[model samples]
Target: MSKEFEIAREFEVDATPEQVWDAVTSGTGGWLWPMEAPEPRVGGKGPFGSEVTAWEPPHRYTNRVEDVEGISEQTLNQLDYTIEPRDEGRRAWVRYVHSGIFVDDWDNQYDAAGRHTDFYLHTLRQYLTRFAGRPVTAFATFEGPEASSAAGAFTAVARALGLADDTAEGARVRAEGPEGKPLDAVVDYRDPYFIGLRTDDALIRFFGRGHWGHPVGVSVHDFAPGADAAADEAAWKGWLNGVFSQP
Candidate 1:
């Protein structure tokens, strides 16, 4: 584990620095990943067992996450986020960096993290733009075959569901599962990195990234009030398992 691997991404956000700060700090930032952290400051606890190492509001923040032991043991994992004002207070720019040491497999681990980061950041933008300030019921889960074994399964599932390789945002999508049930959902968002679908009841997001490449996760955000999130989670779990299980 002498060498370290890094993954970095940059994004332009359509919000003020103060607004982006709140979105990443106090507002719906935690909701983006369903993790809790203490207030942003030095020595504060961050999501995913990370501890805040540096904090500068409306500009920069960084954390070092706990060593991940499973799926081949990684060490010294650090995440840094930098936000800069843009468009004369109408927008902001963000840079995200994830660096770590892997004991054994470096390429697989790095690629998985890269893909996951892309999806998470996209979701953050979606939250800030469309769903900000709205109460949301979020449900997330993981599936099997590990990333190592299922490297391309994410795209496979999309193709199996009849989505073209060029399916992008605003594309009308329709497909059927192994059980002969139709998936009548629109392409709310799509990219080589990920795909998001919006049904009448929920917004479903699927990502190619997974822990060790084994999982192709689907997140559910119900739009209706008093929605049974637990039940929705269970239903999606079953439905996705079926969709991904196709031959």
Candidate 2:
């Protein structure tokens, strides 16, 4: 019989409970860097047809998928979040629990979920630390060959973007990527762990720690009005897929 899986995590952020609450609630799309819930109240609509099941200001929130298009059948999928004041009310303590049923490929699915949870939480921390309250949009894509090493994945993305894998912060950069899209960016942040590029239209980032310690991923935080997010996502996806397929 197919079984179910649950993943839970906790994270501490240098932001207040109210700040974290806004990010979890309606203010996420702006800085949390993904599709956001337009309305975060009970009976309100959210991303991917998710509806708010529980809502408490600056304390707790829960959402569940119901009749959402593009959702895969799994038997169960729910996200519960709890936020509290910590560090003498100077920081936020958060809990995330995601539980769902998987009819097949339980191992890979669970691993990916856990790692992605980590990555997204890291992104949230970065946002709260440096870019909170700034307008932003996010697009992410994953690439495969589960055998690929973290360093190798980082190299591929760096080469594809015409930048050094170990680029230093504050370096002037001009590169062209797949689909002949031109990128005139500055190397803003770089480390053995992550890379960030600042461009005219967006802040781009690539993570070497692909989900589950394999596959590589890139996320673009676009700020332009009327930007075609779907097309941009497709372009990057195709580019990364092609890069990984190369011998």
Candidate 3:
């Protein structure tokens, strides 16, 4: 049997394939995924210094990757992105396939691939959804002696969600802790906030500080016309709960 494994993930974004393609081709766009950078042209730089093997505009892009940094001889790998139009907007599918020898175990590689796929798709969805019609925004609040730490945490979270470098407008942190302080940070579409710190540990603390108001508030536009705030909240809560449930 071939020692190759493949992992794929799909996401629905409220934008046209061209828009999604633009995001995928943008400098900040590639950062949302595992690839270091993506050059649109064939034979151009791809993930991990690989070369683009295929380029089909607004639809599919494929690259040939290699492992040229060790005892392992150069091997061939492939990463592909396919976009399809959907009723709401566009559906994007990213597929990764690896072939060749494996010194250790392939299980870890598979696990990592799965994680990366999930994170990338989630980030893409979040970015395209938030920036679908309006400019991107970053909302943050800080507390405790580690205000910078909190701000850093928020930034890290934003980044993981596909926000770019200039998206943030610095930290609007408060002087006191959660109980006695309030802070806010907002960023535009051209400059989106990308979270860079450890946020999983401070989830409850962050929410308790009343900073979830804007970030978690889903727009009514995402739902049907008759949908109310309660329904929106419930849907968002479910989505968030599902995300947190992931290992």
Candidate 4:
């Protein structure tokens, strides 16, 4: 059965509205997945090869998607962003709306998509606060084994990284890197389904999808110049395999 869904978020970023505009419209890779650079104008090609429905620089932008690889055309997706600059500070208030129609597994898909929406927006705040204007130099993702699809799989990895369940945002984190090195970061965002960390060089996200009956995974968004994404992916893959007890 097909159903309509809406995931909405409103947050403040420590950057100008213009900066937020640049990030979402041009620098999606810093917090979200790598995407083709969006064409800059109304009626131009937007992300996901969708058409730009509305455009008002540094303030409002909207896109509609009717074609997604491997998805039914019964689905229609739209991303709308509204940015408002603060009166007295270098901050911006952003309202993001992602409304669409889902044709398969509506309940499960909505749950997953809702949790992911919060995490992605949190990462956007982290990117603007810490790595503003810096392009994503490297990006990689790794998934855990199916055996790791338990409700506590993400917490298990966090415990291995030396964090307790009570860890709070802004806490200093010292975790073992994939290459056996010490990684120092701060807990930027944390919740039952996700842990977000910001290091000097990267934003790391640990997913607790197992909570929703999906395989847990992680993604690294490196901002360090000349970072090697392929190597990072390989190292994290091996590390995650070990965490999930994959042979």
How many backbone clashes does every candidate have?
5, 0, 14, 0
Question: lDDT (CA) for every model shown?
Answer: 0.68, 0.69, 0.43, 0.85
Off by over 4 Å in 3: 29-37, 68-71, 88-103, 132-247
- lDDT by residue (112-165, candidate 4, tens digit) is 988899889888888888899898999998788897798678877787677888
Candidate 1 runs further than 4 Å off: 27-31, 69-74, 144-152, 159-162, 174-193, 198-202, 209-213, 244-247
TM-score (all chains, Cα) for each model: 0.79, 0.67, 0.48, 0.93
Candidate 4 wrongly placed segments (more than 4 Å): none
Q: Point out the higher-scoring one by TM-score: 1 or 2.
A: 1
| lDDT tens per residue, model 2, 155-222 | 76777778765567788887766686787887766655466776666666676665345566567766
RMSD of each: 3.7, 5.3, 14.6, 1.7
Residue 38 of candidate 1: its Cα lDDT? 46
The order of the candidates by lDDT, greatest first, is: 4, 2, 1, 3
Clashes of 2: 0
Better of 3 and 4 by TM-score: 4
User: Candidate 4, which ten residues in sequence have the lowest lDDT sum?
Assistant: 66-75
TM-score for model 1? 0.79
Name model 2 segments beyond 4 Å from true: 31-40, 66-74, 137-154, 161-203, 207-217, 223-247
